[model samples]
Target chain A: MKVKTVAEYVASGEKPEILFWVGCAGSFDARAKKVSIAFAKILSSVGISFAILGNEESCTGDPARRAGNEFLFQMSAIQNIETLNSYEVQKIVTTCPHCFNTLKNEYPKIGGKYEVLHHTQLIQSLIEEGKLKIEGGAFAGKRVTYHDSCYLGRVNGEYEAPRAILNELDATFIEMDENKTRGLCCGAGGAQMFKEDEPGDKRINVQRVEQAMKTQPDVIAANCPFCITMLMDGLKAKEKQDDVMVCDISELIVQSNGL
Target chain B: MTIAQIIFILLTIAVFTVAFRQFKRVVDNIKLGKSEDIAGDSVQRWQNVALVAFGQKKMFKRFIPAILHFFIYAAFLMTQVELIEIFIDGFFGVHRFFADKLGVLYTMIIGFIEILSVLAFVSTLVFLWRRNILKVPRFIKPEMNGWPKLDGNLILYGEILLLIGIFSMNGADVVLQKLDPAHYPDTGTLPVSSWLGPALFGGLGEGALHMVERFGWWLHILVVFGFILYLPYSKHLHIFFAFPNVYFSKLKSRGEMENMPEIMNEVKSMMGLIEDTGDMSDDIPEFGSRDIRDLSWKTILEAYTCTECGRCTSECPANITGKKLSPRKIMMDIRDRAEEVGTKIRSGNPEYIAEDKKEAGATLTIDNFDDGKSLFDYITNEELYACTTCNACVEACPVMISPVEPILEMRRYDILTNSQGPSDWLPMFNSMENGGAVWQLPDERGAWTKEIEA
Candidate 1:
C-alpha cells in the first residue's frame, strides 16, 4: 500500500486528518497484521484522510514501563513524542488498546499530548456521523461476543465503543459474564505476552477462554491486537479453533461493510 | 502509700517508658525511607480508614475468620476500659473506682465485658485450631515457620491468658467482697465469674481469698504490661498501624502506575522543555528501588502495618500458579530487612554508621551503601518477573498495602541499575530502544496495510 507518511503529507502542503498508529503487534504479528489490514480497508473505504508514521514510528513503551524499566520506557516515549511533535500530529487512532492507553493517559505526563482513540471508537464515531454505512452484509445474524481488553475497559472506562460497532453490524450480540470492567485479563498484559508463562496449574488465557465458551458464540470479537493474539491462542489450545472464529472488531466491521 | 503500692507504680512506669522508646525507634527507622507525599483527598482517606481498618471490610471476604477476628478485636478494645480501671486502682490504692460513681452502669459494663472476654477466649481457641489442627494453607506457608509461627501462637496464648486473668480476678474479688464486706465492697457484676467464685474458692479462708484476689489482680496487670512491650516486635503491631496506614494509602485508581520524576525530567530535557542542567556527575541516578532505603516512607510504613495474614498471597495470580512469588513474603522480607538495617544502625555497626554519615550531604550510589545484601539477596529474580503487575494484592490488603509498588521498583533497579533481568526481556528492550517497537524493525509497521491495498 502506498500509505502516505505525515512528513510526506506536510511536504506536499497538505495535512492528514488523523494519524493511524500501527502498533508492533499490528505491524508484525501475522494474525494481527490482518486486523491492521481490515482497519486500513475500513478507513480507506470511508475516505478518511489518515496518514501513518511509517518507518518513523516506534513502540509507545507501554511494555517497557510495565516490565519495570522506566529508563527504556522514557527513551522510547521521548523518541516517538519528538517525531509526533515535529509533525504537530493532533488526533491519533490505534488498533491496540495498550498503545491507545499509554498515548492517551501516560503521554500527557511526559509531554506527548493528543486526542487518542481506539479503532473501535473511531469506527463507532464514523458510523454515527453517517460517514460510513454498515448494511449488515456478512455479519448479519452472526452470533458474536466482544472480549473487553483490560487497558480499554478497566483502565480507561471504554466499555461501549466496541459494543456500539457490533450493534451497528446487526449481529446477534452475546456478552461474556466477565465483560467490561470486570473482565479477566487475556494473560498477555503487563509484558507477560513476551515471556514464558509463570508456574501455575492453569494458564490465565485458558481460564478466560473457558469463560468465553460458556456464551457459545460463533465469533469472539476483540478490539485490541494483544487480546486477539491471546484469545486466538486460547482457542487453539482448547482445539476450538475450527468451531469458533477469533476476530478483531475492525475485521468484523470491514466484513459487515463488505469493504 | 504502702511499699507494695509504690513498687507496682514504679513497675508500670518502667514498662510504659520502654514501650514508648521502642515505638519511637521504629518511627525513626521508617523515616529513613525517601519521603513521598501521600497527602491529598482527606475525605477519601478517612473513608478508606473507616471502611478497611475499623470496619474490617476486606477481612470479611471470608466468613468464619472475619467473625472470629471481629470477636477478638472488639473484645480487646472493650477490655481497655478494664485496663484503665486497673491503672487507676493500682495508682490511687482505690478498689472499684468507677463502681461508686457509675452505679448500675458500671455493673452493666462489667457484665458486657465478662461476656466479651468469654467470646474472645473462644475465638482464640478457634484460631489455635485453625493454625495447628486445620492447618489453613495461607497461615502455614513456608515463610510462616520459626519465629513467625511461634509469634502467632504466642499472641493467641497471650489473649487467652489475659482473658483468664480478668475472669479469675473478678471471681476472687467476688469471693473477697462476700467474706470481708467492710474492706471489699460488693459493687460490680460478674455474671460468668460469680458462679465460679463460690464453686472454686468457697472453702478458702478470708486471708486466702485476699491472697488469691491480689495474685489474680497482679497477673492481669503484669500480662497487660508485657503485651505492650512485646507488640513492637510482633505482627500484632498491625492493631496499632492499620488505621494510619489506610489513611495514608494511595487513593488513585489501582491501575495507575506512578511515573518516576527522575526519568520524566530526563525526557523533558530531551524534548527541550527545560534547560539541560549539566550538573550530572559520575553517580548515575538510580531509576528504581534497589533496597529498603530506596522505597518511599509510606511503603516502609506498609511493611510495619502488614498483619502477615497472607490474604494477598492467597489472591495473587503468581502464587496461585505455583510461582515463587508470594506478596505476603514480599512484605515480610521488606519488614525484616528494614528491622535488620534499623538494628544495625542502633548497634553502631560500622557499615551502617558510614552510610549514615554519607547521608549528611555526600553523593554516593544508594545501592553501594547496603550491607553486602540487597533486596535481591532475599527476593529472587524469578519471583520479581513472575508478577503480572496485577493490583489484586493491593485490593486484598485489609490495611491498603501495595506490595506491587516495591516489586515494580525492585524490577526497575534490576533492569536499570544492575543491568540484569530475565534473559527473555533483552531482545524486547533492544527492539524498543532501537526501533521503538518490540519487533526487529520500525519500517515493518505498515507492511500489513499493503495486503489490503493490493
Candidate 2:
C-alpha cells in the first residue's frame, strides 16, 4: 500500500490527474481514516493518477463560515486557495460532502475554482465509464439503507450518485422514510459536530437513525464522514450498534471489490 | 341617477383609496431594507412565477391539501368575472346586467362561477376543520398560538362569509326573476344558486326577495373591500405578494449563500493579497442584519410574502427535534420588526431616506425612530445557533422563501459584528485559525497517509 503526495508527484516532473482532498475528518478522525484509505485504494486500483495534498491540504472553512466566523473562514479559504493554485490543481475529489460543497460552490467567489466531485459521484462515474468493477465481495445479499447527507443531497442536488453506487451491489437496498430531498439532517451539519446539542429533546441523528431502523437495515450507508460518524453514534445511543452498522459508501465499495 | 348608484360609486372610490394607501405602505416598508442587485434572468424568474405562483407547483407535493387549495384558488380567480358584473350593475343601477346582453354565454359563465363558489365553500370548511377540529401539528405549534391562530381561523371564516354572500345574492336573484318578471332579468337558472335559492327563501314574497338580493349584494361587496384592507395587516397578503415574490426568486442553488464582497475585499487587503480600494470615509456597512434596515429588500419582501403556513418550521430539523429555531418564526419576526420600524419611520418623517444616503446628522432615517430595538429582541441567540443551515426550510417553502439566509445573516452579526457565539465553538474556531482544521491536531492532517505509505 503506497500513497503519493502532490509534492512527490511534482518533484518527479509529473502531475497527477486528480487531487484527492482528504478533508479534516478523513485525515484525523480514526474511524474516518478507514474511509480515506478505502477511497484511495479504489482510486489506485482503478489505475487513476491521483495524489493527496499531504501536509499542504487545509480545511475548506465550511464549518467556520457556517458557524458565522467569516474572518476565520476567509483566512483559511485564502490560504487553501493559494496552496491549490500554486500547485495548479485543476480537479479535486473529496470523501466529505462539506469539503466537496465548499470547494465546488463557495470557492469560486474567493478565487479558488476547480472541478470538484464527491467520492460517491466519482465512483458512480467510474462505474459508468467501465473503469471500475464492484463484485459484491462483502455484504452480498444484505439489507442496506443509505442516509442522505444534507450537504450532498439538498445542498448540492446529488442524491442519485450514492444510491447509484448501491444499485451496483448485489444487496437488497432499502430507503429510509426520510431520504433524498426530504432527508433529515444527521445532527452534524452547520458546525454542529464540533459543539454540544443546543438543548433539544431529541438529537437529530437519533431521529434520523430511527428512520433507518424502521427500514430494518443490516447496514446504514452514508457518503459523508460527518454523517457516518453521527449515525454510528446514533446506533450506539440506541444500543443497536451490534445489530446495525454504519459504513461510508467508499468503504462499502472497497469491501465489495475486496481491495 | 338613483341614490343607490351615487352611494355605490362613492363607496367604491373610498375603498380603492384606502386599499391603495395600505398597499403603498407595505411597499415603502419593504424599501426600508438595504438595496440588493437581484435584476437579470428575467426569463427564468417569469417561469418561476408561472409555475410556482400561477401554477401552484410546490403545493402539489401534498396531494390532499393541494387539491383542496386549488379549488379555492381557482374559485378566487373565476369569481372575478362575477365581480365585474356586480360592479357594472351597481354603478348603472340595473339588475342582472349581463343576463340579457350575453344571453346563454352569460348563463354559462355565472353557472361556472356558482359551481366554483360551492367548491370554495367546501374547501374553506375543510381548511377550518384541519386547523380547529383535526388540529394539525404544524398549525398548533407554539408560534401558532394566540393572534396567529385567531388570524388563521378568521381568514377562513371570512372566506365562508364571502361564499355565503355569493350564494344568497344569486339565489335571491333566481326567486325575483320568477316572482317579478317585469324588473328582474332572467339569469336562465344558475346551476348552484337556482336550486339553493328557492330552498332557502321560497317562503318570501316579491318585496322581501328584492330586499334580500340587495342585502346579499352589499354584504359581498363590503366583505371584499374589508379583505383588501385587512390583507396588509394579516398573513393573507401572500395572495398578492406571492406573484412578485416567486418572480424574483433567488436563481442560485440553495447551498450558495450570498458572498459578502465587502468582507472578501477587506480580508484580501489585510492579507496583503490586494491593494485596499475601500473608501475610508464611507461608514462601513453592518456585517450582517441587526435590524430590518440591515437586511436586503428581497428578504423583507419574503417576510411579507410568507403565509405563516408553518411548512418551513415543520420541515426544520431543529424545530422538529425540540430546538427553539422555528424558520416560520424567523420570517414572522422579520415582518413584525419591519412593520414596527416602518411605522415609526413613516410617522416621524414621511420622506425618510436610508442611512447610507442621508447626509451626516440628517436624523431623517429609520435609525432615529426604531426605539433602539433590533431583530435580536424578537429572535434570540439560542434560536439562531440552533439552525443547521440544512436548507430544508427553503426547499419546503411553496413560495420560494429562504429563511436560512436571514438566519445566516443574523449568525454573521452575532459572530463577526458582536463577537458573540456559542461558547463550545471557540476551540473549533481557534483550531481553524491556527491549524486550518476544526480540531487541535495541527500536524496530524496527513497522518493517515503513513499507514498507506508504510
Candidate 3:
C-alpha cells in the first residue's frame, strides 16, 4: 500500500480523482486503522485514483467544535480549508462520519466547499458502476446487522447506502430494532469518544450492543470508526467478541471478495 | 347607570390594566434578548404552529395524557366564547344576550359547552390524580419538588373552580328562568347542569337561588381575571406563547447546529476573503452565550413558551443517564433568570440602571444583569459536557424548543470566554490546536496503515 500525499500529487503535476480524508481515528486508533486499510484496499482493487493527505492532513476540528471550543474549531477548520483549497481538491471520501459530516456540512459555511462522500456511499457507487465485485466468499449466509452511526444515518439521512452495500455482499442482512433515522448513539458522538463516559445506569454503547445482539448477528457491520470502537468495546463487555465479529462495511466487502 | 354597575366597570378596567401591563413587561423582557430574525417561510411556520400547537401532534406521543390534555385544551378554547358572553353580561347587565336572536343555535352551543365543561372537569381530576396520586416519573423529577409542583396543582385547581362556577351559575339561571319567564327568558340550554343543578338547589327559595347565581357568576368572572394575571408568571404562559414559539421554530435539519457568524468572519478575514479590519484583535467578542441576554430572542421566547411537560427531559440521553443536564430545567432556568433580570431592571436598581443608561443602544449581555450571576452560576460544567447533541430533546419537545442550542452556547462561553471546560478536554484542545486532531502528533496518524500492510 504505497500512499500518495496531495503534496506528492501536486509536485508530480497529477491530480487524483478524489482526496481520501483519513480522519484521526482512521489514522491513529489501533482498531480503526484496520478500517482505513480495508477501505484503501477496496479503492485500490477497484482502480480508483484517490490520494490521502498523508502528513499534510489535520483533524477536521469536529471534536473541538463539539467540545464547545469554537476558537479552536475555527483554527483547525481554517488550516484544513487552506490546505484543501491550495490543493484545489474537488471531491473527498472518508471512513469517519464525524469527519465526513464536518467536511460535507460544516466546511461550506467556512468557504471550503467540496463534494464529500462517506466510504459506504463511495462503496455503493463503485458497486453500482460494476467497478467492484463481491462474491460473498465467506459471509454469504452469515447474519450481519449494520449499526447506523448518528452522523451518517440520522443527521445525514444516508440509511440506504451502507445497507445497500451490505446487501450486495449476499449476507443474511438483519436489522436492529433501533436503526436508520431512529438509531441510538453508540455513546461516542459529541466528543464523548475522547472523554470519559458520563455517569449513568448503563453505558449507551452497551445498550446499543444489546440491541445488536437481539438480532443474533454473526457480523455487526459498522460504517463509522467511532461506532466500530464503541460497538467492539460493547461486544467485549458482553464477552461475545469471539462468537460475533465486529467489522466495518468496507472490511466486509474486502472479505466477501477475498481481495 | 346604577352605582353598582359603575363600580363593576371600574373594577373590570383595573384588572385589564394590571394584566396588560404585566403582559407588556414580558414582551419588553423578551425584547431585551438579542434579536435573530425568524420571520421567513410563512407557509412552513404556519404549518408548524398548526401541527405542533393546535394539532398537539407531539402531545399524542403519550396517548392517555394526550386524550386528557385534549379535552382540557379544547374545552378551554370553546369556553372562551362563553367567557365573552359573561363579559357582555357583566358590563351591560344583559343576561342571555344571544339567546333570543340565536334561538336554537344558542341552545345547541350552550348544550355543547355544558358537555365540554363536564368533560374538562373529569379530565382535570384525572390530571390531578396523575400528579398527586400516580406520581408519574416525568412529573416528579427533583426540580418539581417545591414551587413548580405546587404551581402545577394550583393551575388544575383553578380550572376546577372555574368549571364549578359555570355549572352552579347555569343551574341557578335555569331555576330563575322557570320562575320568571318574562325577565330571564327561555334562552340557553343546559343538559347535564339542568338535572344536576336543580337536584342540589331545587329546595332553595327563589331569592336564595338568585344569590347563588350571583355568587357563581361573580366567582367565575373574578377567577378568569386572576388566571389571566397569573399566566405571565406561571408555566401556563405556554397557552399564549406555544403557537408563536412553534411558528418561529428552527425549520432547518435537526442535526445541523447554527455556526457562529462572528467566528466565521474571523476565519474569513484570516483566509484573506475580506480586509483585515483588526476587529478580531479589538475587544474579541465572546464566542458563545453566558446568560439569557446573550441568547437569541427566539430562544428566550422558547423559555417563555415551555409548558414544563418534561417531554424534553424524559427523552434526553444525558438526563436519562443520571447526568445533571435536564433539558426541561434548562428552559425553566432561562425563563427564571430572564424574569429575575427584568424585575431587577424595572425596580431601577442603581447599578443596572446606570449601566443601561450608559450603553444606550448597545446590545444587552450578561453584564446587564449587574448581579454577577451567569448561566454558569447555576448550570454546571458536568451537565453541559454530558450532552451528546443527539437532538432527542428537540424532537420530543411539544412546543418545538431546542434546549441543546443554549447548552452548546453556554459551553462555548465556558471554553472560549472563561477558558474552562472538562479536564479531559485539555489534551484534545491542545491536539486540535497543534495537529488538527485529538492526537498529540501528526506522524502517528499513518501508524494504522503500516500495521495493516505488515
Best by lDDT: 2
**What tens-digit string does per-residue lDDT give for candidate 2 at A53-122?**
9878888999989998888888888889989999999999999999999999999999999999999999
Best by TM-score: 2
* Candidate 1 lDDT, A61-142, residue by residue in tens: 9889989888788888888888999999999999998999889988877778999999989999998999988876696667
Per-model DockQ: 0.41, 0.78, 0.48
After the best TM-score superposition of candidate 1, give how far the Cα of residue A161 lies from its true spot, in angstroms.
8.5
What DockQ would you assign to candidate 3?
A: 0.48
Of 2 and 3, the candidate ahead on TM-score is 2
| Candidate 3 CAPRI assessment class | acceptable
Clashes of each: 5, 0, 1
Question: Which 10-residue window of candidate 2 chain B scores lowest in summed lDDT?
Answer: B349-358
Ranking by TM-score: 2, 3, 1
Docking class of 1: acceptable
Task: Point out where model 3 deviates above 4 Å.
Answer: A1-19, A38-51, A87-91, A119-147, A157-182, A198-202, A210-221, A249-259, B2-8, B171-179, B183-191, B194-212, B267-274, B351-369, B441-454
Scored against the true structure, residue A253 in model 1 reaches a CA lDDT of 74
lDDT of 2: 0.89
